[model samples]
Target chain A: TQLLEQSPQFLSIQEGENLTVYCNSSSVFSSLQWYRQEPGEGPVLLVTVVTGGEVKKLKRLTFQFGDARKDSSLHITAAQPGDTGLYLCATVPFNKFYFGSGTKLNVKP
Target chain B: DAGITQSPRHKVTETGTPVTLRCHQTENHRYMYWYRQDPGHGLRLIHYSYGVKDTDKGEVSDGYSVSRSKTEDFLLTLESATSSQTSVYFCAISETGGSYEQYFGPGTRLTVT
Candidate 1:
């Protein structure tokens, strides 16, 4: 089974701070997706990285896929209260999919 | 929103009781999935359906069953509810051909006491 391990299970920081979350795996993945879920709601897809060593940015969020396709990272800059949520990483391998444990981020005002 | 909706936003049931959750989508997606979310476990796949009547077990499928009789509706059934089964369930949809992008539903919170 392919497993994705996430670090810093929980994080709390003040507004305007920067933080990075990681997702690592021993198996290569065809694609990786990042999602942010708010309380009482389903997760919203933030980005998808398909190629090894790929990097994508969305506003204050940046996502990077390792060259081995077995790891990924999410960096948030100038965090705000709106950025507080549970961030999840999911990897797709053929017909199977695996999700990381998740990182709960709390951005204080 | 993914045009997906899950019925019974919250349910409380006793152990051994049978329960079924319903998922409906307006996107006509060919792939539908069921997942459970726990405090430390972000989300674990319970089951997934590629097409009508074509379903497969996921990482955590024990004691649970699912069916997709129509393109828009997928149903997840718990043969016997257990305390361990108490968690938030989510339904997701994706197009065929391995786009790998899944759109998620609001979610259902089930409590087995």
Candidate 2:
């Protein structure tokens, strides 16, 4: 079985603070996706990285895929209170996806 | 709001009781999935359907069953509810191809006491 490990299960920082969360696995993945979920709601897809060493940015959020395709990271700059939520990384091998535990972020104002 | 919705947004049941959750989507996607979210476990898939009557087990399929009889509807049932099965259930939909990037529905919070 494939396992994805996520770091910093809990994060709390004041607004404007920058932080990074990581997802790592020993097994290679064809694609990886980032999702953010709020309380009482299902996760929302943020980005998908398919190519190795690929980096994609959305607003203040940046996502990086490792060259080995076994790890990924999400960096947020100038974090705001709106950024508080649970962040999850999912690896897609063929058709199904296996997800990392998750990182919970609290951006306090 | 990916056009997916789960019925009985919140439910409370007792152990050994039978419970069913309903998922409906208007997107008509070919792939549908059911997942459960726990405190530190992220989201674990319980079952997924590739097409009507073409369902398959996921990583965590024990004690649960699912069916997709129509393109727009999928159902998840628990034969005997346990406290361990108490979690938030989410339904996801994706098109047939690509990375199958999924869109999730508002979750159903089930409590087994």
Candidate 3:
């Protein structure tokens, strides 16, 4: 079983549209991080949320940690073609890192 | 970009052959990790090192072994390559463990035939 579950598994949208991806788990985490992986590249860190109910904005992206610390969400406003990539959510619980299956986003021009 | 590089960015090996992938870093970080990324599985930890010569098994460590004789280098070896082991492997580094942001290497794609 996957420690973290992400949905929808795949998504495609026209440029300027808005979308949100979710990461959910049954266990609480000390911190949650969001990463974006482009084709032929490693995942890159986008944001890290450590506090429950904390929300952080990165340009057009917004990340929020759930109050219970078992969930997190990433929202993209006015998505662009450059935002096309695989979105993964990860956490380091008990000093071990776990990653979600990831949501593949395709923002068409 | 972090000063991390994985050798032979891509490799193809036959079954039953031993293969070793090397991860070199210049960040001087204390923590190094090896992870394999497969379809529908994101990235799963294979092994990790907290300091030179101090390592631990990750969630999926079977058939794999790691050596960290130096702080700047970590190596992952597959005793006998299997087709199921074909996947893109990534190396990551963190200044400290637990909640610290990790910097990832470009990754090495391995194909076992």
Candidate 4:
């Protein structure tokens, strides 16, 4: 069983479209992080949410941490080809890192 | 750049052979990690180090062992390779104690036949 569960294991949409990826868990975390990874490379941090009910926006991307700190969501606005990659959610529990079963996003031009 | 690198970016080895993957960082981070990424499994932590000679097991510690004798180097070893161990291994580092601002390396593609 996975500690973090992500929805829409895979997503493919055309440019200019909008979409949302979610990560859910029963346990609470002190902080949640989002990362984007391209093929043949490692994941790059996109954002980190530390507070409950916190919402952070990075240009066209929006991130929200659940009020209970047990879930997170990533929203992409006007998606583009450059946004195509694997999006993963991570958290630290018991001094260890746990990652969600990522959502692979493909934005076609 | 986080200044991380993994040796033998791609390797193919037969079963029963011993294999070791090296992870080196130049940032002199205090925390290092070893993880394996596989389809449907996401990124599972195999081992991590807090400081020199201080290491701990992660969720997937079986069949793998890690050593951290120096601040900049973390090594993962497989006593006897098996086909089930084939996957992409990633090395990550963080300067903070809580895994803050963690960064990953290019990864090592291991093929155990």
Candidate 3 RMSD computed on C-alpha atoms after optimal superposition onto the true structure: 0.6
Q: List model 3 lDDT by residue over A26-99, tens digit each.
A: 99888899999999998999999999999999999999999999999999999999999999999987677899
Which of the two candidates, 1 or 4, achieves a greater TM-score against the reference?
4
- Candidate 4: the clashing residue pairs are none
Per-residue lDDT of model 2, residues B44-89, tens digit only: 9899999999988888999999988899999999999999999999
Candidate 4 local Cα displacement, residue A63, angstroms? 0.2
Q: After superposition, which runs of candidate 2 have C-alpha atoms over 4 Å from their true positions?
A: none
Greater-lDDT candidate between 3 and 4: 3
* Chain B structural similarity as TM-score, candidate 4: 0.97
Worst ten in a row by lDDT for model 1 chain A: A90-99
| Per-residue C-alpha lDDT of model 1 across residues A18-40, encoded as one tens digit per residue | 99999998888888999999999
Off by over 4 Å in 4: none
Query: Chain B TM per candidate, please?
Result: 0.96, 0.96, 0.99, 0.97
Cα shift from native, residue B30, model 1 (Å)? 0.4
Full-model lDDT for every candidate: 0.92, 0.92, 0.96, 0.94
Error of 4 at A107 (Å): 0.4
Q: Considering chain A alone, what is the TM-score of candidate 3?
A: 0.98
lDDT of 4 by residue, B1-113 (tens): 88999998999999999999999999989999999999987899999999999999999999999999899999999999999999999999998756387899999999998
Alpha carbon lDDT of residue B103, candidate 2?
92
Question: B38-107 in candidate 1: lDDT tens per residue?
Answer: 9878899999999999998899999999999899999999999999999999999999735467889999
TM-score: model 1 vs. ground truth? 0.97
